[model samples]
Target chain A: MSKKRDDIIDTTSDLLERQGYFATGLNQIVEESGAPKGSLYYYFPGGKDEICEEAIRRSGASLEKSIDRAMSEADTAAEGIAALVEGISRAMEASNFGAGGPLTTVATETAGQNERLNNACEEIYESWRATFERYIRKDGIDSIRAERLSTLVLATMEGAIILSRTYKSTEPLQRAGAELRELLEFAR
Target chain B: MSKKRDDIIDTTSDLLERQGYFATGLNQIVEESGAPKGSLYYYFPGGKDEICEEAIRRSGASLEKSIDRAMSEADTAAEGIAALVEGISRAMEASNFGAGGPLTTVATETAGQNERLNNACEEIYESWRATFERYIRKDGIDSIRAERLSTLVLATMEGAIILSRTYKSTEPLQRAGAELRELLEFAR
Candidate 1:
């Protein structure tokens, strides 16, 4: 990817992370990136929706990498899942509350309206779920239950971020971790 | 609230639920409510900021009541949580994967830039946490953990709705409910 395009995605992600996918405008992305109009159009010919899909994919990939990083750093899936939740907690705090998982806001805003964006988000969610499910399966969770558990964990983290932001606290994410831990114990 | 004021809130809420807070405009609200040009200012003396705040509060109250009703109908807090998640699941399905939440979208969109809307969202979220905490406490969890658990459940549900709406499926919410059930078994 060109530096100009990366800059565009980086700025758009930050803007969208702070605001939302819908609230962001192509002009804002260009303004934030300080990139020339010719470059933006040359780099992302498909425009905002296309840029948005790429940004969502990037957010999802980065999140999956974090989960993978957490998993690799731990001895067990349980420990890794715990670390992943807390990792998100710290990350959310660093974002000062408005920072939720990127895909949630985009997914909500584009669900029924933008088919291209919706498809990208669906696949992005699957990637995240698969990241969690890999560890769950390694730890002996049946495939069906593991998939469900993965779905639930993803949803909870996304949701918790929203409440945590709204209430300006990390306590929600922390408690949600405990609940997840308890359920994982039972799954084992 | 005055009839005009109520109309404004209802229309804004619906629009925000379908679109989002930032994406929604005063002109659209004025048009949708069929109010005179001065009616919005006359009723909401503070203008769009106040109207947005009031709309959030009204939407919050409605959501909180829906949760309370679902909780009351259930035999246990655990079941009530599931019922609430399922109720939202059905709503997401009914909406055919459009934006399923207004308060959440607004909270995420304005969490950093808008103080009035942010504070209003805070109050709304705090009230929800309190409501969930109240019922969970009735089932024997201590105050501290109950508060945390309430926030977690709220987050999980909020996240679930987003995913469910995006995927045009209830799998995320259903799976979230199952995991939640596993966690709540201790309380039961």
Candidate 2:
């Protein structure tokens, strides 16, 4: 990605999290990214949908990497998971809770309404779930259990972020992370 | 709610699920409900936000009732929960998976943007969680664990519905239900 394209994706991710796919406009993206008006069309011939698709994909990947970093440096998968959860909490603060899971709002807003965005969101979620599943497996959980565990973990994180942001309290996320970590042997 | 009010609520729910709060306009609600333009103002002084709040609360109450019904009829809280999960799957299909969860989307969309709607959704979620927590406690799970379990169930349902609707497949919901059942048990 060009520096300009990267900035466009970065800024769009912010807008998508803060608002939603429908509410975030090209004008806003240009205003935030400092990308020229024509540049949006030049880079993304497919328009907002295309830009959102790329932004959402990067959001998932970046989240995956963050979680990966948190886990890899931990003493165990359990701590890694804790770090991952805390990482999200920090992100919630960084975005002033204005920014949430990118695909969540898009998934809810456009799932049945727009097939293209829906598919993009679906891909993003599946990829995130898969990333979590890999970590769950790496944690030594059984395969059957890992998949389910990963699903729950992802769902919990997604839900917690919303609740924590909505209530302006981290209680939900804190409780959720504690519960999940307790499931692992690493809980002290 | 009056007959016309229910019609508007139902229509708004469908629109909110498929299109979202921002994308679904009062014009569409008026057109879909066949309610007069003046009627919306009468029912909701706050317009769309009020309508969305009412719809979300109604949907939340409906879901809580399902949980109560399932628990009351079940031999144990476990089966009650299982039945509730199954009930959600059927309900999603009944709604054509057009829109997933009302509270989830409403929370994400308006939580930060709209304070009144945000508080209403917070209360809705808290009420549902309290109800679920009540039964989970009755089922013998401890207090803290029960709350966490309820949160997990809500998240999984929300996530599964989004995935199911996107893929037009109920498999995620079903799979999520089974996993949820496990979490409920595992929480103990």
Candidate 3:
């Protein structure tokens, strides 16, 4: 991607992460990215929706890579999940308690309102679930149960983010991580 | 509540649930509620902030009532959770996959941005967690673990709402319900 194009995505992702799709304005994206209106339109003709779709995809892939790195670092699935929990807690604390990443807030906001954006979120979530299922499966859980458990894990993380952000504390995410690890280990 | 006051809240709650804090307009609330512009200002002198704060509190209380009713109907904590999950699934299906409720989207959207709304969301979550902890304790779980598990349950439910809404399916929620029930039962 061109530097300007990349800047647009990077800036838009941050804004979307902090605010839902409807709350983010195009002018703000241009101002934050330092990209001219003409340049933004040149890269993303469909404008805000287009930019958001790409941002969600980019963030989703980036998150999956992070997950892979986190999961690979640990000797076991349970430990890997714990590492992720800790990582998320640290990140949330760093942000001063922001729930739902760029992908999440935008995903929920556009779920029923925008098909293109909603599909992007759905694809991202499915990819994340697949990643979790792969890790859980290594622990000897069957494929079907692993799939279901992966969904639960994802839900828990997402929900915990919301709570942690709302309370402006990491306790909810930390608590969720420990409980989820226990549940996953017990499943095995 | 007076009929006009109730109308204002109901409309604001629906808008906030669908659109979050920044996206929900005061004019939209008045138009949707049919409470007249004068009546709205008369009731909520602080405009959108006041209306949103009240809406969050009202929705929070309403959700607690629903949860209490669901918990009361079931024979076990696990069963109670399943009932709540089923109810949420049906409601999401009815709304064509809107995640969470009035409380969730607003809570997340306003987290850290607006102290008043954030506090309202936090209080609501705390009350819900207390309710869940009470039920978990009834199942012979200790208080400390029960508190943690309650947070986990709330996180899972909130996260599952996001997924279910994104995929436009109730499968995520249904799967979470089963997994959570298993985990809760195992903790006993």
Best by DockQ: 3
Candidate 3 residues B1-188, lDDT tens each? 69999999988888877766777898888789888899998999998899999988988898899998898888788999999998988888888775467777777666767788888889999999999989889899999899899999999988898899889899999998899999888888
- First chain of candidate 2, TM-score: 0.90
The alpha-carbon RMSD over the true interface for every model, in angstroms, is 1.6, 1.8, 1.2
TM-score leaderboard ranking: 3, 1, 2
Clashes of each: 1, 0, 1
**Which lDDT values do the candidates have, in the order given?**
0.81, 0.77, 0.86
Point out the worst 10-residue segment of candidate 2 chain A by lDDT.
A179-188
True contacts kept of 1: 0.77
lDDT of 2 by residue, B1-188 (tens): 58988999989987776677788889999999999999999988888888988887888888788778888887656677678767777777887777466677777777678898889888887887787778888878878788887675665566666667776777767766666675566555
How close to the true structure is residue A120 of candidate 2, measured as C-alpha lDDT? 79
Candidate 1, superposed: residue stretches over 4 Å from native: none
Give all TM-scores, in the order shown.
0.95, 0.92, 0.97
The digit string of per-residue lDDT tens for model 1 on A1-188 reads 58888999888888878888877898898888999878878988899888888888898888889989998788767788799888888877887876776676677666667889989998988788888889888888899999888888888778777777776888777878777776776787
User: How accurately is candidate 1 docked according to DockQ?
Assistant: 0.69
DockQ of each: 0.69, 0.58, 0.79
Local lDDT at A173 for model 1: 78
Q: Candidate 2, TM-score vs. the true structure? A: 0.92
CAPRI docking class of candidate 1:
medium
